[model samples]
Target chain A: METPLIRLVNVHKRFGNKTVLRGISLDIMEGKTTAIIGKSGEGKSVLLKHIIGLMQPNGGEILYREKPIKEMSREETRVFRNKMSYMFQGCALFDSLNIFENIALPLKEGTQLSPSEIKKMVGERLRQLDLEGTENQYPSQISGGMMKRVAMARALVTNPELVLFDEPTTGLDPIRKNAVHSMIASYQKELGFTALVVSHEIPDIFHIAQNIIMLDEGQIVFSGSSEEIQTCETPVVRQFLRGEAGSMFID
Target chain B: MTMHESPTQGSGILHSLGAIVLYRIQLAGHFTLFLAAGFYHIFSWPIQIRKILQQVYFIGAKSLLVIFLTALFTGMVLGLQGYYSLVSFGSEAFLGSAVALTLIRELGPVLTAIMVAARAGSAMTAEIGILRISEQVDALKTMNIHPVRYLFSPRLAAAIISIPLLASVFNVVGIIGGYLTGSKLLGVNPGVYFLRVESSILLSDVTGGLLKSLVFSIVVATVCCYQGYFTHRRKNSFGSKSVGLSTTSAVVQSSVLILITDYILTSILL
Candidate 1:
């Protein structure tokens, strides 16, 4: 069997008295899109954060390319970070930078590309994202959908090996959601990079994700293909699928 | 039961007081650690010259006008007050010496630092706090950039480089303002006024004031940056209100620390 590109071994995370992730163990295959779906406050974003070494697990270890992130040296960690990119839920574009400058930042800071070379790459990424003629605009000037596209362009500008997305389609209209979903699908196909997306959009995200993992109250309740999820008779899963508050409501 | 309840009330008061003390001590410890981390990165190779220059422009050049105006008015008031008091003793010729000595030793550095703490330091706190709230700082970290190296060190380094220069400018402008008031306005004779100032002011006094300004700038920058960087870590609810509170606390803490540091330096230097 091929070794997984990333592995989480019994990962656990807690904030204060609240336990966020309770012993999560999973394997992320190479060059595949995995979607994590959960109700609000279920640690899906926290789990994604652990994969990128942004937040450390309280217990257990994360392996990037089969090497433990904890054991990586500073130079190794820097290289690991360069190979991965994270798109924040709120876009997290630098307020001080324009769209072009925002997209150009990682390339300018992380790579040895010349100014013209950087410009060429950034321009190409912009065109790919359908963001032409919006270079000088600040993030606030653009609509939410455009901001998400700009963020996506920035995350992909470096052509990283793994992209971690935190709710990329949240708060977007269905049209914008479709645009983002298609954008992610096209980019994953063309770039051939592994993607881990944390999203709440149900049936829509199912189309893009090859594998789905459902988290509830910090534990993995289900992990399988989308078809398996559809046929699964789990009560929590059924309630979540129907978008209803089941008998498990807590006051 | 009543005796037990009385003991419980007494312990509750003690516990509350102890918690407050512990909280303050923890905050101080965190601030010291933050300052140490910033200093550690200061000597790292590949210095960000562009960022340093940008901070210097923001902290120094931008503060020039306010410092100039403040010094001018302060000197004029000092000259007016000193001339009148000295005239009572027939020692009005010492007006320039009083003005120059007061400014060089105490007023210039203290007032300039307070102004900077109010203006530039508050701005640094607000900007960084906003960045923290908006997750830009996290974004920087995920991009493999050290937030302290990219943010705090530059501002700290710039403030250290600029504060002394600003204080010197304040001194110069203040002396001119005093001269205009005492010599040109009050007819104390420019020669005697300048002579008294030159004779009374020592090199050590000027150097000491500049040293105080340097320390004050570091305090302001460190406090402001620490507050901003740890906005999310604060116990309060995380939002714009928290950022506002951090900004206010930064200014208050920096200004208070400046005054306290001034006292300690004065005690040691004098």
Candidate 2:
């Protein structure tokens, strides 16, 4: 068996008196797309945050390539963080920065690239995202789909080995959503990078994920291949995939 | 748990102590870097003079009325207090020196900084803190441009340089107010008062106050920025309460630091 690129060992998290995650364990394979599907508030984004080292699990550990994320020192974390990119759910582009500057930021800070080299690299990424002409526009100046693309371009400008995406299609129209999904698929395939995508858009992720994990109330209720999920006889998975209200959810 | 300890009680105390030490170190480091970055921005002149002129209109020119009113009352009070003290010593003729020294060397910078902290510094903290909580800071961080370099350097630079200049204006106007109050209302000799002031006051007194103002600027900017910058989470975690707390802390912390530093500088310089 291949060594998993990302691993969570009995991860747990809580907020004050309420438990948000409870001993969740999973392995994400290298260079494959993994989709985490769940209801709106079932620790999906929380799991993404754990992988990116944005939040620490209250108990247990999260590992990237056998290295525990919490054990890394500040400088080590900076280096580790540079190797992975996160596309936030809201496409959190800097409102103060134009598209070109936003995409070029990580390269300019993390690499020894000259200004012209950084410009060229940013231009290439923009071209890849079909955002070549919108380089000078601010985040607020663009549509949500274009903003998502800009964020993706920024994330990929450094050519990270792992990408964590939170609801990449969440506020876009269906057409734009499909466009973003296709772009994510193409980028993963072209770069051979590991992707952990969090979303409720089941059909789009069904086309993209090599493996699927279903989270319910902070626990991994189902874990299998996309085909396995399709064939599973569980009422929760079937109802979720069919868009029906099930007993798994209230109301 | 120890005999004296409730569950997790000692741990909380230890953490609070550690946090205090950590915050002190962070504040010192932040203020040092802030000062250096501010000087660099000032010397580099990255921002155009037109913008500075515009800010002066807002930060300095618009603040003139308040500064004047506050200074006038402050100087008048100082003069009244000085006359009584000087009469006790049979040196009421030294009233000009008393008013000038107090206004120029102490109250001028400290009071001006407190006012600016109340007016401008709180607004700055609120604006930047809201921007931070809204994911703007994360956006800047991901862009690879140091938010400190882009966002903080200019404001810190402007505050350090401008606050002292504003204080000087306040001092000069305050001394003139004192002279009017002392010589016109109190029947003191203007020539005697002016002569005593000219002989008694030194350039070092004004320098001490300006230096204090510079320190005040660094304290205000660093505390405001650090509190805002560190408290933001790139999600739905940030809100108006954090901004409000940060602004209030900036004003209070900066005011206290200004007062403490004023005493220290006075003792050292005088």
Candidate 3:
């Protein structure tokens, strides 16, 4: 069997009395787009956070390339983190920085790239995200959609090997949502980087994601390819798909 | 769990008291860890010279006028009071030394520290708290940048280097203010007053005052930065209200800690 790039072996997490994740064991294959879909408060974002190392699991271990994350030395941790990028749900751009500076920050802080090279790379990302002419404007001056794009631009400027996107199209309009999905598909294809996206755009997200994982109340109810999910026999998965279909044309 | 319940009442009270004590211990432990984190990143790679300079400008250079005014008024009042009290004993000539010694040995460092804590310290807390609430700090971590290195370390370095220098400025301006009042205005001999002032001050006094200021700067910076950095953990508040609470707690705790540290340091040094 081929080695999976990222593996979770019975991971668990709880906050106070609330258990957010319960014994989550999953594999994320390399160079593939895996979309995790679930209802609200079903631990989709929490799972993404654990993968990104923002929060620690109360139990079990997370492995990247078959090496546990906690065992990595400081240098190894930095190298490990450098391979991945996370697009936050809230588009957490620095309010103090202009658009260009926000996108250029990861490179400036993490890489040995010369100033001109950083500027060139950031400019390319801005152009790709269609965020031109807003380089000098701060995040406050931009709209929510523009801020989302700027955040995506920031996450991609580092040219990471793995990108974890948390709700990249959460609040966008249908046109922008499809556009963003298309962007991710094109970028993943062109860059050959693994993309792990957590979103609920239903059929739109499923179109771009090759594999899908559905979580119902902290456990993976179904995990399979996009084509396979349509034929999934699990009750919750079937109900979820039915519900998704019900809302397809209603709103 | 109600207080009037018979069997559980005593256990409940004990539990509540134990929880409070444990909470205090946890707070102390967390603050210690925050301090360690702040100091550990002080020598991190790619020295952040620009950010330190910006903080220096905010903490030191911008505080000059306020320090001068506060010190001048303090010294003038001391000189005036000293002259009046000494005239009856035929010791009016000691007015300069009185003003100079008080300002240099005690008032200068304490006032400068309090002023900086009120101004730059509050701003630091508010900014970091806002960053914590907004997830900008988490974003920094995701990008492999340590938030302490990017934020707290620069402010720490700046406050350490700036507050002592500002205290010295305070001492100079205060002595000058005393001279204007005691010698020029209160009719003490200019030569005698300055000679007494020069004679009374020792090297130990200046160094001791600088040391006190250094300690105050560390406490203030650590408290303010720690409070702001942990704003997300606050139980009773969230969002901008938590930011406001953090800022208020930073300033209040810094002020109280500065005075307490002053007394402790003074007793030890004395």
> If scored against the real structure, what TM-score would every candidate get?
0.96, 0.76, 0.94
Q: lDDT (CA) for every model shown?
A: 0.91, 0.81, 0.91
The TM-score obtained by model 2 is 0.76
Model 1 stretches astray by more than 4 angstroms: A248-251, B1-18
**Shift in Å, residue A64, candidate 2:** 2.1
Best by DockQ: 3
Model 1 B-chain TM: 0.96
RMSD vs true structure, all candidates = 1.8, 6.2, 3.0
lDDT of 1 by residue, B172-229 (tens): 8898889888888898999998999899999999999999999998998999999898
Error of 2 at A18 (Å): 1.9
Docking class of predicted structure 2:
acceptable
lDDT of 1 by residue, A106-187 (tens): 8876777999999999999999999999999999999999999998998999999999999999889999999899999899
- Candidates in descending TM-score order: 1, 3, 2
* Rank list by DockQ: 3, 1, 2
Which regions of candidate 3 deviate over 4 angstroms? Answer: A244-251, B1-18
Query: How far off is residue B202 in model 3, in Å?
Result: 0.2
Candidate 2's displacement at residue A228, Å, is 1.9
lDDT of 2 by residue, A164-244 (tens): 888999988989999989999999999888899998897789899999999988899899999999998887778888988
Best by TM-score: 1
DockQ of each: 0.73, 0.26, 0.84
Candidate scoring better on DockQ of 1 and 3: 3
